[model samples]
Target: MLDHLRHLLAQDPKLAKVGLTGGLDIWLFRNSLKILEWAGSARDSYNSGNTGLIQRQAVRILDYLDGTQYVQTENIPSDIQPILVDPKIARVALLEVSQSEEPPGYLKHIGNHLREIISSPNVNDSQKKLANEINLAINNVQSWYLGVHDDAAQLIHMSPQQLHQPGTMMTLNHMFKLANNAFVGETDPATNQVKEGVSQIHYEAQRLATFDIMACSNNETSRPCV
Candidate 1:
């Protein structure tokens, strides 16, 4: 599933841009990281085979996150807070662990059995705090998953007429700017071509503006705005 998603994104730059703008790409990428972390611990035959592919995809997502200024660290969910706080550690765990003959025991020690570490008699205050933060972070990932899905569903169900409302259009225009910035230098693997991200955004903005005008016109009832 991850491989197919990556291939689809590579083949279609427009679809990739849309996914980024819609927040689906980042959501899936973050989930992939979480799944990779789980699979790393399990190390069973089924999960082990796809570890390399998931790692590569995670790396690509990390690169995109690093390059794009639009996705702020704060925008990422708390569960994946380590990615924002200590990106190097996250990168090493994702990219290097699979290459090792044995499981990366050091990485495993960080979050695995966090509850046990927090409750152990020998643990210090700092260690307990770290364990609590890890636990919170994991919980945050689950929160983000539910929240984003609800938001996406709301947008999906919106009527075209409702979407063309002034406030919604303004919000969309702002989102377009952010998406344009993120996709600025991205290359489409299918055509091996770079897209004019800003230009496309400008065009969309103009179209929206035109829609706003048409919707506000005297013949509003005669012609459908959407």
Candidate 2:
């Protein structure tokens, strides 16, 4: 079921990028491993009326799908796909599956990983299957994520903090903003008005210089602060 969804995303250009939004999206996306792990764990306990390991997992999947509307790759449930057309709705949907304090920020990392996996030169058919599964999982989260929140047409109103990501210019910009705070430049005597936002920007830039993405994220030791 999950694999089918992954293939759907891999085939569809429009729905593929939904995984980069939030934490819950990642957990449910990564639910691939858990769903499998739990099944394996339950196998030995099924004789005690546990409905068998597969049944237990199926029940769990049903609950998630029934309440959250997450479907497998093979079954492209109509309603959920349409809702996911809007990015914000998708983001909110992902946020729904995530814990408030989820670490590793799964969706963000998985999206990053997926991007690379799709482009790798040595990839084979099996790897592609896994890649697609991950993609579908991402879309499943997006499907639910987009169902009950901001749609694509709305104005985006997010803080800079939430918008943070990698890239040289972005790093430099944050650093500049962190180091510069009090709006520099000369003030006019007659008008008694301020003349600059440079100081404020500079203050932010300085602070950003010490901002270690590794220390901040903890899980990402490779991320540099500069």
Assess each prediction's global lDDT (C-alpha) against the native: 0.33, 0.33
lDDT of 2 by residue, 1-226 (tens): 2322232232222234544432232234334333334334333333343332323343332333222333232232232232222232223222333344222233433454555655666554555655555555444433432331121101012222322323322322332222121113335699986433322222322222131122445456654444
Candidate 1 residue pairs in clash (backbone atoms < 3 Å) = 79-137
- Model 2: lDDT equals 0.33
Residue 158, model 2: Cα distance from true site in angstroms? 23
Candidate 2: worst-modelled 10 consecutive residues by lDDT: 148-157
Q: Please write out the lDDT profile of model 1 over residues 72-140, one tens digit for every residue.
A: 332432323213323332322211223341222212222334555556665556646644654444443
Candidate 2, residue 169: Cα displacement in angstroms equals: 48
- Tell me the lDDT of model 1 at 64: 29
